[model samples]
Target chain A: MNQKLFFTTNILILTTIAFVSIISDIGAKNYTYKQVNASDPWARATSKLAKTGAVYIKNIHNKGKNAVKITGFSANIAKKVQLHNTVVKNEVAKMQHIEFLEIGPNKSVQFNPGGLHIMLMGLKRPLEKNSHFPLIIKFEKLGNLEIMVDIKNIGWSQKKPSNYKHVHH
Target chain B: MKKIIYSILIILVFSALSFGVFFISDHYAQKWQSNKLFKAKLYDVNGKTWSIKSLKDKLGIIYFGYTFCPDACPTALNNLTIALEKIDSKKLQFEPIFISVDPNRDKPKIIKDYLSSFDTIILGLTGTDRDLKSFTFNIGATYSLSREDPEDENYLVNHTVGFFMITSKGASLPIPYRNNPEDLARAIEQIKSIQMSNSKFKKISSIF
Candidate 1:
C-alpha cells in the first residue's frame, strides 16, 4: 500500500509539470502570433464631393523568420482600391501606384500622409467621422485578415508645421 | 588703323542695339503676361464668369489641384489657410483661390464643398479644359492628367504645387512661395513692398 501511494504521488507530480510546460508553450506561440499583427488602421472622413480617400495602416512584423508581404487589399467603401506612394519631385506632388509592400522580419511599415497609402477610388459614400468600415488585407503567407478602419476627421494625421500658428482676429 | 577703328565702331553699335532689343522685349513680355492674366476668364464655384480683375485689390494666393488629391493638395491648402489666418486680412486684402484641374469631377458644387472644409474665405474655381489651359498658360502653371481610360474615375493628375501670388493688379508676382507658412509670410512682405511701390508710382503720376 505504501509503494502504491508513492507511485500515485509521483504520477501526479509529473502530470502537473507536463501541464505547466504545455501551457507556457501555448502562451509563447500566441505571443509570436501577435508579434506580426496590424494596428492603427484608420481612414479620413471624406466630404460629399470627394470621389477618393486614403486609408493608413501600421504593419508590424516581429518574427525573424519570414518577411510579410501585403499582396492586396479590398474594402466595401470604394469600388476600387490600390496601393500608392506620394512622390514629391521639384516640390510637385505625384502619386505612384505600387504592386505590393513587403515588411521584412523584425520590421514595420507605416502608411501615412506624404508616404505610402491605400487609395480608395470611386467611394460609394462619404466616410463620416467616428464611423468604421471593414477592410480585408491579403498577405502572401498569413492569407487574409479583416480589419476595421476607424474614420477620423479630415487631416487628422497631418502634423502641424512647427512655425504654423493660426491668427484669428 | 582706319580698318580697326571701323570694326570697333561696328561692334559697339551691335552691342547697343542688342541691349536695347533685350530691354524692350523684357518689358513688353512682362506687360503681356500681366495683361493676359487680367483678361483670362474663369468660372467661379458659383458658375459665374470671373476674371483676374475680380480678384483685384486683394493679394491672391492661387493654386491648381484636383479634388481627389490626397496629400499635397490638402497640405498646400491647409498651409495657405493657416497663413491667411495668421495675417490681418482686413489690413492687407488677401484671397486664396483653388482652381481644380479635374473639372469633369469637380463641379461648382463639389468644389464649394471641398473648400468649405478648409476655410470659408477660400474661393474654389473650376472651368473647362480650354479655359483652364489659357489661364494656366498665362500664370505659368502646368498640370496633366494620368493616362487612363476616359471612363475611368480613378485617374490621377500631376500638377505644379507652387503657390502663385497674384498682386492686387491681377499680375502674377515673380516671387515663388512653396506652400509653407514662413514663405507665405515672406510673400506677404513682398506684396506689401509692391503695394508701397505702386502707391508711390500713383502719387508721382498724380503729380505729373
Candidate 2:
C-alpha cells in the first residue's frame, strides 16, 4: 500500500470508533416513566372521588448525569407552586417540603402521594370534576414535556394517600 | 325458706346500688371531657373558614402553634404524630388540626407551605386576633407571642402542647395517650376498646 493511503486509513478508523462510542452513550442515557393523569395522582387515591386539584406527573425516570429541572409551573388553576411529602413519626401526620427533585443517570424520580408531589397551592377557581388541565414540566436535559391531567370527583372515601396503610378501626 | 328469700332480696338490692354508682361515675367522667374543650376557629391556606364543628363524628387532635415557631411547635407536633402511630387505627378516627396563634406572620399560604413537611393530616388555621382569643379560650388552649428579633422576620410563639381527641358528635373520645410509646399504645388500645363497646351497644339496640 502507498504510504499516504496507509496514513489516511488509520485516521479514518479512529474517527469511526469515536463516532460509534458517542452514539452508544446517547442511547444509554435516556430515562422513561409511565405517564400519569392529574386526577388520582397522590391525594386522590385516598377517596374514589377526590378532587384532582393538583396535576399528576408520573413515571418521571431520568438517566442522565444532571438532576431534572421542573419549571414553567405558572397556570390558571394554582396560585402558588410547591413540593409536598407526608412523613409519619410517632403516629402523627406531618407534611414536608422539598425544593428539588433529584434524577440521576439510570435513576428515576417519583411524585406520588404521601411521598413527593407538587402542591398546587391557591387554586384560582374550584377544580371542576372530570376536567383536564395542561401542565408543562421541563427537564434540564430533555428540554420540555407537556402532560394533560384529568380531574376526578372530590370527597371519595375509598381513596387514601399512597403511603397510608389502613388501620383496623 | 323465708330466710333464703330475704337473703336473695338483699343481694338484689346490693346489685342495683352498685350499678347506680357505676352509671353515675361514668356519666360524670364523660361530662368532664366535654367541659375540657377549648374553642378556636381555624382557617385554611386559602383563608377559608375551618371550624371544629365540621369534623364532628370524628376525633379531633388540635395543636396551637405558628409556622415561625423555633422548636416547640415542630417537636410537639412530631411527638403527637408519634403518639398517633402507637394507636390502633381501627379503634380511633382522628384529625390533627394546627392553629397558628400568630395570624400576622403565619398567613394561609405560609402555614400551608410549612405544614407540608410532616407526614400527618394537619390543617393550618389562622384568623383575626379576637377570633383567635375566643377560640383559644373556649378550647382551653393558651398562646402568647414572644419578642421578635431584628435579625430575622420569623418570631417565636409560646403555646400549650397537647391534643384534644373528640368524638364525631363533639364529645370527648377519652384519649389517655402519653409521650411514651408503650403508654400511648396502651391508651390507644383502651380508646379502641371503648369505641368498640359503644358500637356494640348501638348494634344491640338496633337489633332489639
Candidate 3:
C-alpha cells in the first residue's frame, strides 16, 4: 500500500511539472499584448467614393523589457493593409510603404495624419462615423494583438471631436 | 547735306527714347500682373465658372488636394478651416477654395458633398485633365496620380500639400502644409500684414 501511494505521488508531481512548463513555454513564445500596447487608436470616416482608409494610433509603446517589432497589419474592412509614411519634400508630398517597425524597450512610436499611418486598401465598406472596427497588429517576436479602432466624424482631422468617447478594447 | 544730317540725328534720338521707354514698361509688366490662381479656369461645385478672381476685395485662400485623400487632405483642410475661424470678425472676409487634382474621380457633386462635411463653406472646384494640369503647374504647385488609370478608384494622388493665400491685390502667400493650426493662423495674419504693406507701398508709389 505504501509503494502504491509513493507511485501515485510521483506521477502527480511529474504531471504538475509538465503542465506548468507547457504553460510557461507558451507564455514565453506568445506574450500577446502584454509586451506592447496601442493607444488612442482612431480612423476617419470614409465617404462612399473613398477607395482607401487610414488608421491612426497616437502611440505604440513597448511595455516589455525587450524590443518588439511590428511585422504586419490587417483590418476587417480592408482586403489589404500596408504601413505608409507620408513624406513631404520641397512642398511635394508622397507616401512611402514601410514593411516593419521596431519599438525599443520603454520607447513609443507615433502615428498620425500626414505622417506614419496604417493604410487600408480595397475597403470592403465605408467606415462610418462613431463606428468601431477591429484590426490585427502582427508582431515579429510576440503574437498578434487585435485592436479596436474608433472612427471619427468626417473632416475631424485636426481636432479630436469634442464628443469623442474612447472605447478601450 | 548738313540739314539732312541734323534731321536724321533728331529722329534717331526720339526713336531711341521711345524704345527705352517701351523696354522699361515691358520689364515691369509681370510684376503688376494678377496671380495665376485667380486666372485659372475651373468649375465650382455648382458647375459654374470659378476662379480666385471672383473673391474680389477679399482675401483668397486656395489649396490643391483631392477629396478622396484619406489622410492628408482632410488634415490640411481642417487646419485651414480652423485657422480661418481664428481670424477675427473685424478682419476682411476671405474665400477659401479647394481645387481637386483628381479630375477623373472627384466630380463637382462629390467635391461639394465632401466640402459639406467640413465646418466652413470651402469652395470645391475641378477641371478637365489638361486644364487641371496646366492650372496647378502655372500656380507653382505639383501633383501626380498614382495609378495610370484613375478609373481604378483605388489610386492615390500626390500633390503639393499646403494652402496658398492671396491678397486682394493678388500677391501670393504660399504656406507649406503643417499640422499645427497655430502656425496656419499665424501665416494668415502674415498674409494680412503683407496686404497692408502692399497697399501702403502702392499709395506711396502712386505719385510716381
lDDT of each: 0.73, 0.54, 0.77
- Clash pairs detected, candidate 1: none
DockQ of each: 0.36, 0.02, 0.38
Candidate 1 local lDDT, B1-208, one digit each (tens): 9999999999999998897676667556766777876666678888898777776577677889988886668767776776676775453577788999889788888888887776437788877898788778888788889857988767799887777777655556544645566677677667667866865654444432
How well is each residue in A1-169 modelled by candidate 2, as lDDT tens digits? Answer: 6999999999999999999989864342222333211222322211111111344444455555555555445455566656555444443334454565555555445454334555565455544555666555655555555555555432221223354332110
Best first by TM-score, ranked: 3, 1, 2
For model 1, residues A1-169, the per-residue Cα lDDT tens digits are: 9999999999999999999999864332121243367666777777777888888765434465667777888999899889888776765668988888777676666665656788898889988988889888778877777777888776355343333332111
Task: Please tell me the interface RMSD, in Å, for model 3.
Answer: 1.9
Stretches of candidate 2 off by over 4 Å are A1-52, A63-67, A87-95, A155-169, B1-34, B38-192, B195-208
Order of the predicted models by lDDT, top scorer first: 3, 1, 2
Alpha carbon deviation, residue A137, candidate 2 (Å)? 1.4
**Can you write out model 3's per-residue Cα lDDT over A1-169, one digit (the tens) per residue?**
9999999999999999999999864332222378787777788887676667789887677888998888999887988899888888889888777888888798777787888889988888888888889999999968899888888886565344343332211
Between candidates 1 and 3, which one is better according to TM-score? Answer: 3
- Top of the candidates by lDDT: 3
Q: What does DockQ come to for candidate 3?
A: 0.38
What stretches of model 3 exceed 4 Å from their correct place?
A: A1-32, A154-169, B1-39, B88-92, B148-152, B167-170, B199-208
Q: Residue by residue across B1-208, what tens digits does model 3's lDDT show?
A: 9999999999999998887676566434534444454566789988998766677788777899987676778878878878887884343577888999988878888898778777788888899878787767755788987786846766778899878776645566676566777798887777678767867765654443
User: For model 3, what fraction of the real interface contacts is kept?
Assistant: 0.59
